[model samples]
Target: MKNVVLRASSMTQSGKYLLRSIQNESMPKIDLLIRECLQNSLDAAVSRNKGEKVFVDIQVGSCETKKINALFDGLTKELNKRFTSVTVDYISLRDSNTVGLTGPLKEEDIKEEGNYGNLRKLVYDFGQPQVEENSGGSWGIGKTVCYRIGIGIVIYYSKIKLAGNKFESRLAAMLIEDETSPKSLLRSAGLKNGNTSKGIAWWGNEDINGSSYPITDEDEIAAILKDLQIQAYTADETGTTIIIPYIDQQALEINANPYGTLQGKLKDYIGLAVQRWYFPRLYNKEYEFGAYLEFTINGYKIRGTKIRPYFQEMQKLYNITTKAILNDNQNVEKPSDIYIAAIDMNSTFSDGRTAGFVAYKKYNEAELSMLPPNNEPQPYTLLLRDDDDDDTGNMPVIAYCRQAGMVINYEINSAWTHGLPKLTEGEFLLGFFQPNGKKRLRKPDGMSGIEITLDEYLRSTERADHSNWEDKEVYGKKQRIIEKIQKNLPKKIAATYEESAEERKAKADQSLQRNLGKAFLPPSGFGKAAPVRPKTPGKPPATPVFKTHNLSFKLEDMSFSDNGSVCVPFSMTVKNGLDNIHLYLKAHTSQQEIDPGTWEKDIGSNFPAVVLYENLELYLGKVAYTSVEPVYSSKHVCYGIHISQLDSCYNAKGKITLQGKLYFKHNDPTISIRVVAEEGDR
Candidate 1:
């Protein structure tokens, strides 16, 4: 066995550049590493072996530097120069009950239409498309996450059973670094022969052509595994093992205070990450196609029985979604505390069969405290955290995924969850969305009308990291399936939380007088006692010329703007004849009413910048001087329009209608504006 460092060539990607391909700031680098590795492992599970559970084991430990220094030929001197330690920390991941990288060993043997195999795809290729249908990976760049968490040195070992019951084990290693760096190990190794370094090196058996191939000698593989202190797969076992050497333990524990020790914190994080991304498939037995996932970290098994306190709510939500899909979403019983709804997400580009389901639940502090205590935090806190404000409390979160059962994203304060109601103190809302993978869809015209599953459709919308679903344009037109989902999801959730039967009855009774069109109104004395008049009658008061028959306002929509401001759109109606109307707005809070003029003094922000009325933009703190124009005063927070002015402006005599939006600098959704309409000037 020998080490092979490629010579720099045109358009070649440096190791440092490749390592940064999967950088996700929202999640910790350690968590990202775990997620990507497990996703690939789950995707490689053997499908033919029914009822066989797929198990993944992650071992974190250290090995003496001198013990395995000889494994890397050209990079040994550089390793010793960089790390000043007797032992090197490492992380190993092994998966059982799976197919272990079965494919042609040589690059020239690959074919366009034939199976590229997992071995070549993972070890040699970059950014290749996933050949498997409904697979978790799409861009194939997720493998770079391995290099991100370590010193860019990773070893791969896999054992596959051939057709004749013979077993073959393949072992290889790769080291990546910024070859251009003045302190680069590859540069220090002098492997480039005075030429620029490609920043990549591979270790394996050298063939006659000077090309490196995986070491297939079982004896050699066993010796190396023992030296690295990695648990080897048995002779009869078939799976893959990944070892990343020289890991930064402190880097993995950044910002995490779950445990007192580094190892404890690492273990807690690994377990939480596994449950966060794979809870849907963990111990699930509902779907025959869904593989059960078992996870272990440093010899500690993460089983459903012990981790229930951390993920019980999410598990329940997953069950609700799967059951709805299994029953064809027809007449399925839902839990009283949970609200489940399904939406037909089919569009013009679809085959008229695609659908997505959402389930929502609210938990109070009391209910949350019932879970058993543990060193790690609950999944809700991890899933529903507001990225912008740490102390803003838990916000409404919607965890969404495709049929693969791995969560694609936890959406908070995004367009996908724009209309969800704000959570009050002491409670939070959790929601889950899954597209029906079984539903088939066909592309629109100019694209050959090719059929694809809903799962495939959703996968097309994911970026390389598979973190969020985005809108993609096809044939120069927007697909808009995601748009439709976003637009309809909150409406469905709101409908599920509709008023109770008794509440509806009471509302009906209160509105019955108005619903009867004012014809069946009761007389003043019809059902009451007689009135008492004053002894001396005074001069009757003069009646006003203008009277408002009906005045009402309704909030149409409320949402957060791009700059973290609150936007409110409302509509107001003014019935009957009127000479003038004055609209006063006050900041309404639970404590007191604050006039718009003093909004800045009370709430530390200015009033709405402007109130929009159709094409007329009325700037607050200004006033109108003409019939078609409007203005305001800095001291008085009033918007007044004369009926005679409206008559001359638009020829609408004695009638006025207003609909516009108010843009406030404040972001608190709980704060509202109260509107009071009066006759003439106040």
Candidate 2:
């Protein structure tokens, strides 16, 4: 049989635009490629069989361009014209023990339901709806990540068992590039005329009508696979293999250099990236419904036993959540080390079901030290940039996913952390949330409601990248459900660790009394009524100095700055004081005041930036005083503002008000202000 040639339909899409459309800013391109490809493979798990594990192999290597240059028709010309290279590095992802792209081989054969099947959806289609329920992909745009990671050329091969125990193999190739480029594959193939070419071309069996279809001849596929130096699937094997030629090796090695002595290879990064996003699925045996994912890179398997230690705590939390769902019990008791709190979406959204549960565990220095350490860097550190060696003051981290078990995101700070208590020194919090996929809800409609599963509700909140859940007004009243979930996450987590009401009130009272005594109370005999004495014969009785008993400082408003810092507007009133008043600003948690010096030392950053009041700025450990106005300076304990003597009689009847804005850096913890006032020298 003659080799297939490249073909492009009339008025198709530009490859460059398609690649850019699905670009994810939050994740690196290589990570995105791995995550999306793996997700698709999992979604295509064979439905006829149960208890079968899906096997995925990610192989990276280089091959001479001339060996397989003839397979892609005009691809060789474009490659030679664009890049100066003898060999092209490629990444091949193959999966078996699952269903391959099963669908119509031609576009006109699509069903009335607009079902393009896995083959068309992955290779030719864009933004198609997912046919299977509870599928991991919703946006239908994930496949573009493959094109973006390479030179916009990808080969597709799949082997599937047909009726009568017969086996069939499919092979095709696609090249997407900037059509505007003079050396574009579309132009070289003579498919471009002015703006007609979408910068996309495909290589396959060309029909009389010029439409391309996947080549079904096993001999042709084997010849091409042999030339490319990729292993061909056996006759009995079933699954898909995606080959991305001319991969940008440097793009895959972007953050690999940070890992000391790892040689910054693609395999090292690929292993960690797999564990970072897919740990929940790796070697998971508790849940029968969840797919068991097996991964390998360069023929070396990523063993679950070896990588489990790094994510043992999180994995345990995931298992607990999974077990709760499996047992049909949402109210799971908190264990000694972990707290499993059920997020009751029914309470807020009136859905009559729990959205999910958040599993939280605080690891102190001693607890973290007891865990086994791996010489290789932790996956979270490489992916999240969080240093695990420094166990103190690690911000409360939470990773959330859906029923698919692919982590949607790992967030250190977000709306889920708001109103949550701050972690103490030498401690950090880790949590994971998975929505109740089995539960169902009714989305609001005109005079009626559309029933949907909680998984679908949450999936709607995710964008194309599936990084974070956001509330879009298009979801209608369902948006309120998303909002409630975000608002309730911290509340539920706090409920698990918060102190009793009486204990809280007592603590609050102590903090209030301490701050009041230091900031409001005057010294002995300064504000008290003095005893009268007879005037001396040669001297007049001295005039009594009035004490300021009505000094008030209140926080008027607080907001977030553009850079995520905190801005506080405050008002201070002085009534009937002729003495200099020293004011101190402190960042206070529920328990006690945070010492600026101690905070800077522990947190690895300055406690907070200087508090600006008009033309004066107050920092830590420094004091600046104006002749007739207030003195401002940063102190070791707190920021200080010193005000000189004020007119006692003039401002006695009317309150003299001072208002200013206090600015704090973005990294500063959530805290209330503690203002202290003391009498200073005249």
Candidate 3:
């Protein structure tokens, strides 16, 4: 055995791929970035407030060409005592504490206060980057994308400090410019002096230059901070006031004409993106955040209103959350649960994605007759929501996508140039995010909206996560939602076409007769006949003439006892009745009127007297048993003829003459006729 120990190589593995930071200018737009920032602030406020009641004031005006200001404040307090204890070695500590932050951070530590970093500096600055050491910080590079766009940011931090018997308050503001090496500048504007205001003095001396302009009153700053902290009780006074003096170059690029148009568009785009990811900042009561972003041209402030998908419009387009159950286990009291959230919209704007409607339909229908033949499958549209109000937009159209359990977070890329999906003529953009957390986009085809295949979606999900059975659950839920949607599709479509109740009822009745006739009533020894009747006397006489298909018959009436045994008062006449008609009749001497929407067992038959005489006759006129189809279509043949007193059956090879009018008992349920007869010959 070799006794020499294995020696490690002096030179380590090399050639590790170094990812170059893409220039932020290549990003889509600042609108999306600003929106995301504003969202972060709002989320911070909501989390602190315990509800979504934070007020966001956006100012889009300019002291120069144009400026945007966002103020987020709801629940806030003074900085914790720990911040005061934070060591500021300024030399070796700066290098060790510097790297790159995973998320947004205060500027005082990132750059020298009151300094600047232009585009070149941002790219070439050798100064070490400051990284977020806070456990609550986000993944790196997300917010950097915003800063790289050259959009200025100012953050004001206010926190409560708890010291022995005495509380202190403090405010810190740091502003950054869009340059190679951004500078963190502190505004000397809003400052206050109180007994033992050591933290305030220290922060100011380190970050801001003392100034006397703009009413430099320390007492006023303290009062403002005190009042701004909602439900905050601190032994000392503390708060923050952020001010941004510079705007993003891309934001400046947007056209400022049409006051609300630019702002509205940008807001919409940005608002959607913010709605996607989680907002954890709003959960802390120690901080209340909001934004007041304004867009202006020259110096005039521009006004804009938010846009949202109206609930009323949504009601028109699609249904609310739908539920379904799968019958996998018969013994289980609770079947498998499935849920699908889909919004249907008008077909015209579907492709444009201007309307937030989704195309939700069943995947298994052989022929979805409820949908117009021209109609195709489309994906569910994305809806825009404002945590504040609805009716924020005119055009209700917007785009949406879903795959399995995952759906597109419109709030992530609303303002990104490439993020906005395109709409085509007769073709809507469909996006689906599956439970397996995958995304799929589909284009509309023909009159039908875009159709996302369930099989394909499920298959993709299975491939993505083999171990996650929950993916299958998601697919099941989506399928259930689709089924629920399909169940109500006919009614929804009918509502659009404005189909009448009578028409609907008639069609339904016909359908029922065709599909479920055997279940309701089986075929007796009767021939086919159109269920029509000729008006006659309300009650049958003792003996009357029975008129049938071109034939007549007179029969003697024999009166017997009651109890539905035998009652033939006199002779009966069968007129217009065809020859060779086999007839069996029962006479009811009672008189009554049937009420609507009511049915009774043994109710009088609903057949005509003439056709009823045919009894078990299968052939009428020259038409044999096999020729029944042609005779019925020709309209030259008749079936059963039910009289006033009873029903009569008839069938014949040729025309036959009959007798006088027949009578029937009014409101009788037991009398029915089964017969076949001919009406007219060529």
The C-alpha lDDT values of all candidates are 0.66, 0.66, 0.25
State the lDDT at 526 in candidate 2.
38
Model 2: residue 229 alpha-carbon error in angstroms? 1.8
In model 3, the runs with Cα more than 4 Å from the true position are 1-28, 42-52, 63-137, 145-170, 173-204, 207-242, 248-306, 310-682
**Clashes per candidate (backbone, < 3 Å):** 6, 7, 154
Model 2: weakest 10-residue lDDT segment is 516-525
Cα misplacement distance, residue 303 of candidate 2 (Å)? 2.9
Q: Which digits, one per residue and each the tens of the lDDT, describe model 1 over residues 255-292?
A: 34333323346767777777778888776665334467
Q: For candidate 2, lDDT tens digit of each residue in 1-682?
A: 1223323455556666777776566566777887789988888888623355888999998887777665666555655666567788999999998789888888878866776788888877788857576677888887888877776778999988888998889998877778787756666756543446677667887777666789998787888888788888886989999999887777668744454424447777788778778888876665356467877788778665446354666777887887677655656654777888777765333345677777888875444443234333333464556453231234677888888778888766578777765454445678888777767665445545556677776787777777878765533543566677778988888777878869866754554444333222222223452333668899755333224466554454345544333455555566654456665555566666655555555544334434434434322113232323433333222254566645542343755555565554322334445444455654
Model 1 misplaced stretches (Cα beyond 4 Å) = 48-50, 111-114, 255-264, 303-310, 346-354, 370-380, 384-394, 445-449, 500-682
Predict model 2's lDDT versus the native: 0.66
RMSD of each: 12.2, 10.3, 25.2
